[model samples]
Target chain A: MLHVFGHLNPDTDAITSAVVYAGLLTRQGVEARAFRLGEPNFETAYVLRELGVELPPLLPELPAGAAVALVDHNESAQSVENLAELRVLRVVDHHKLGDLTTASPPYLRFEPVGCTGTLLLKLHREAGLSIEQQDAALMLSAILSDTLHFRSPTTTGEDRDAVDFLAPVAGIKNVEAYALAMFAAKSDLGDTPAETLLRMDYKAFPFGDPAAPQLWGIGVIETTNPGYVFRRQGELLAAMDHVKAEDGLSGVLLSVVDILNETNHTLVLGATEAKVLREAFGVETQAQLANLGHLISRKKQIVPTLERYFAPDA
Target chain B: MLHVFGHLNPDTDAITSAVVYAGLLTRQGVEARAFRLGEPNFETAYVLRELGVELPPLLPELPAGAAVALVDHNESAQSVENLAELRVLRVVDHHKLGDLTTASPPYLRFEPVGCTGTLLLKLHREAGLSIEQQDAALMLSAILSDTLHFRSPTTTGEDRDAVDFLAPVAGIKNVEAYALAMFAAKSDLGDTPAETLLRMDYKAFPFGDPAAPQLWGIGVIETTNPGYVFRRQGELLAAMDHVKAEDGLSGVLLSVVDILNETNHTLVLGATEAKVLREAFGVETQAQLANLGHLISRKKQIVPTLERYFAPDA
Candidate 1:
């Protein structure tokens, strides 16, 4: 059996992608399953429930010599354990290539679009396979979640086209209203712990050398109102410190995006270096203040900015 | 006009890819010309002269906002000056991607293959275009050059397929003879400065943190017999020092591969640190000698070893 999964922290794209792509792979004649590496976050859980699709079983670690296909991500740091030893049948991602090399060549498709769902939509079409209703809605939700409702700079014409194509198939007449509902579901952190909330959309960047390194983690909190996280800044910062110590993170940052206004406000806690962050964003060091004025998407904006800051010469 | 070029130190793959890809681009109805970032070395010059084709003009720097397509390389260190500011329309490379990101979406095709010439052959076929006689021979020569006459560990089935497909079209019934001629042309470095010979196929790897730094550069010299370069070790070491000082390179290494026997003997000259090579290959720090036992290709055999040595965790 082929086990398909995404990166570690199961976001909407990661979760839905595994499920939707596993369906595609199965239709193409593989006994594949969608496996979640962890529990889905609020947005993914809400969307899966909305689509009436059960979540895949949580897979903490991969078994030895398993045959698998990875969706949404390929980084070993964020992928299944023993990735290099396993047979990676296919990798479909939109992120920068990391150290995930296969023993033999596999089917690999990578594009610089906003979402893996965009690629999925294209792939399903290319394969002459129609997207199922639940997967269509899941695809729509995944695209919206990754692109931040098409406000992200990573949102290409292809993404807009995918949303338009899937939105109707998803039986949604009003995308704006659907996006608002989805964002609201994502916004409601409810009783989730501060560390889990912060880690929900976390991505790490390594600066300097890979060995004896300087590394920082940036976690994003996207909500309709930034005030939800900012109201609990002290608790979140303490939680960020906890994550920092656990992960050996040199710096920890939480980018709280106001989905309604399309603006970003960040809180930073540095265990070591913050020069890259300060230089890249022109933000004051060790400060939890300032609006980045209408920038919400992490892929197109935050990651790129932080990448350049971390490895300017790379 | 679309300006197309390859890496700085013009190898066969770098040079021919520009010419062949430019030919393809032009046939597909774009005004394109192959440009060279630096002067072609002996083999490229010899092959181009034999084919009765003029070398592209030497382009030391790329002007800001120039529309360009890069072939065989995407790293800014090996590409045109001001690559970040320039509009990169397309990138076709077979190497691991370094920090090459564009302001907008561009056509990108990256394959982990033996040669960029191999990629060009596949691309040309996909475009439904036939290779011209000169271009076919150039492509054949390039594949032979980069893969060390198909003996390098990086050589793949696709590369062998490309060679077989192109051999007849290139008017060479004897592929071995053709490869020998090409290798002989490359092997005759004949009075070329040691720095120039080494730089002909040099690829550098940056170690440690990008913010502060430990940097190392590796250069390979593949020949039918290693005696030519090994005989002039002192001059080569002096040239290595010159290159080290000029580039702020931490340590410089020359891997001299005896192509016929498939054995590599390396020379080491370290300005500051030799620990990476020492740790990686389990060699003495400054001993300037070791038989690497039939490891010819830098990409497959040498690079991965060096990368692991540099970053064990990565």
Candidate 2:
């Protein structure tokens, strides 16, 4: 059986792409099953219902000793824990390269697109697969969610290409309507602050300092109310601070999404240089914390900004 | 197996709703499988792919004996051929009621909202089904597509309620972004006129003297180019006129959608009541034919306009 898996803390794109791609493979006579790493947050559930598709079973943890084909997330040894133990058969993602093993290489398919769904769309087209309507709708939703509905800075030609390809198949004459509906659904913040915080997927990265093994932790909080976000900023920071002190991390970053304005309010805590935030974000901050809006996503928006900050020195 | 079917010539909402609803049912230990009536059009395919879900297998000619659970389209024996033979087990639609057999019905869930997917979302909630991320995304997409991203006049409280329920699960903070992307993708009309016309789902209805039944078809044509639409109008009318004259139809109506503007331009032919067109559309026409712009939809905009002129007393 072909095991189609996506990254830890899967987003709509990551989860949906895996499922659709697996379906395509199944239709082509391949035994395929779709799976996701981590539990699906609230927003992902909304998208699955809209597309009339079920979420693949959530993998309580990464595949410890199963053959896997990864999608969406980077495939560094750290990203795919126990990678050496499992047979990495394939890698399909949209992120920049990590330390992937070339000696025992998998079928790596990485493109500079906004979502892994776009790459899968290309493969489906190239393979001349008979795309069904429901599958098309799912792919379209994945692209919309991953690219922040195509507003993310990391969106590239491939992302737009896939959207253009799938738009007609989805029977959507106007994409704006779908985007607005998705945003309106996601912007409600009536839940507890912790729920909102945990509803999203997060990643932890090594800060490149051996002395402080846990260098940084990042999470995204998508919402509409800037006031609510500002109100809860302290709580999030305190939690991050505690995690950082306990884990001996250098810094923590949280991207609070302002759904109405299509911007991100960045919150930084810990020992990272304020200059790093300022240089990457082009905004000055005196306090150990920074609240910068309009950045939206760390992978698409924040990471690029961080790269710019690191480019001059490194 | 539990057959989960949608309307003939299913749209994104129809197809996606079927797939997701089936998924939910299957998760609940029901042996559910999704089915579509006809070949999936372009937009529906895009939507399904985005969700990473398999498109249900195309039903083998509307189930001569199989029980059907209809979604989106209303159940009218007059509209659906061979309805007298096939067993319609259940109907979950969000449209004006047509004559249906409710006396010996299986489950019947009808709501006057923008889409069938909205009703499905309610059912998921009522059943206390825990939706997966992909399913939630699909539902979110369906809401946007059916409600014109909440801009359509047909939008109702139920539609909004469905959106509110599904947005968080889809992980969308601002649906406007998704709407914009979906609209932008649809606005690009590089394909031929026939391709564009076939991209959307279509339905046929009998229009004429009750004694002489004939098909007066109405199908949505999504495109941005008014000139292309204007040209296609002639071709569509000629084709429809040929079919009408051959089959002794009284008239036919075609709705050309300028998806970007959320407006419909109608082309009416074969009917003698040109004044009905004038009175309903506020556009005076000679030569026994009419072409009108700024209309909403054939069901919401054209039918009311025509009914006023044809059967003013009713």
For lDDT, the strongest prediction is 1
Residues B96-197, candidate 1: write the lDDT tens digits: 655565544456666667888888887787667888888888888889888877788878898899999998888878888867776777788889887888
Winner by DockQ: 1
Model 2 agreement with the true structure over B1-314: per-residue lDDT tens digits = 66777777677788888888778778878777888866665556666766677888887656555566566765452234656445655556665444343212144455456877777776676567777888888888888887778777777787787788787888877777776666545545455455336325456554433334444456676554556667555666666566556645455555666766766666667444355566656776544335565665666666545543453233
- Superposed by TM-score, candidate 1 places the C-alpha of residue A88 at a distance from the truth, in angstroms, of 11
Query: What are the lDDT scores of the predictions, listed in order?
Result: 0.79, 0.64
Question: Residue B33's C-alpha lDDT in candidate 1?
Answer: 84
Q: lDDT tens digits, residues A1-314, model 1?
A: 88889988779999999999999988989899999888788888888888889999986476766889888887777887688667786777877665555533355667778889998887788667888888899889999998889877778898999998998899988999888888999998987889888888887766544445567788888898677788888889899889889989878878888877778887766524355556777756545554566667676677667665665345
Clashes of 1: 4
DockQ, cand. 2: 0.01
